[model samples]
Target: MAWTWTLETAAGDVIRRSEDFESRGDAESWIGEAFGDLVTDGVDQARLFEGENEIYGPMSLHADE
Candidate 1:
């Protein structure tokens, strides 16, 4: 199954979605690199999905304050 991320704001509003990934690792790595820019663009968190099933996250893009 393909992996993807649903990017959202703190209020759970969807802002953007990621491209489909070949593996979970690839998805995670892309987020690791992109989340900084995402945060700048108002993405507050992200959820990972494998096909129709959520596999991980609502992971916060912001660091602890």
Candidate 2:
């Protein structure tokens, strides 16, 4: 199964989805590089998935505020 990521707003609305990644590490790295911009764009949460199965998150990108 391919790994992918969903970036979301604080309200739990999906803002963007990543293209399929070759590995979980690659997906995670993409998120790390993109996280700052995502937060600046109002994405307060991020979710990871392996195909249809959610691996984790709605993890916070914003600092506690």
Candidate 3:
């Protein structure tokens, strides 16, 4: 189970999406923080989606040596 954040422009023409979390709470929190700034300007709305396998983990990790 994971969470996804989606942001659509005011015109609903452009869309931005991000997903890389294991907790829905974390995802929504991030979305709120990010969208809060955009909304102050022109962003119309923001949405959060939660479901199983919405995102995959083991996300590329690299050691800097």
lDDT of 2 at 39: 81
Clashes of each: 0, 0, 0
Evaluation by lDDT, superior candidate among 1 and 2:
1
Best by TM-score: 1
Write down the TM-score of every candidate: 0.94, 0.87, 0.51
lDDT by residue (tens digit), candidate 2, 1-56: 89998888888899888889989999999988988888888889989999989999
Q: Candidate 1 has which clashing residue pairs, if any?
A: none
Q: Which segments of candidate 3 are over 4 A away from where they belong? A: 40-42, 52-65
List ranges where model 1 is wrong by over 4 Å. Answer: none
Worst 10 residues of 3 by lDDT: 56-65
lDDT, candidate 3, 1-65, per-residue tens: 56775555644543565666677778767755665565655455545556634333222111231
Query: Global lDDT of each model?
Result: 0.92, 0.89, 0.53
Between candidates 1 and 3, the one scoring higher on TM-score is: 1
At residue 17, candidate 3 shows an lDDT of: 59
In candidate 2, which residue pairs get closer than 3 Å at backbone N, Cα or C atoms, i.e. clash? none
* lDDT for each residue of candidate 1 in 1-65, tens digit (9 for 90 to 100): 99999999898899978999999999999999998899999899999999989987788899982
Sorting all predicted structures by TM-score, with the top scorer first, yields 1, 2, 3
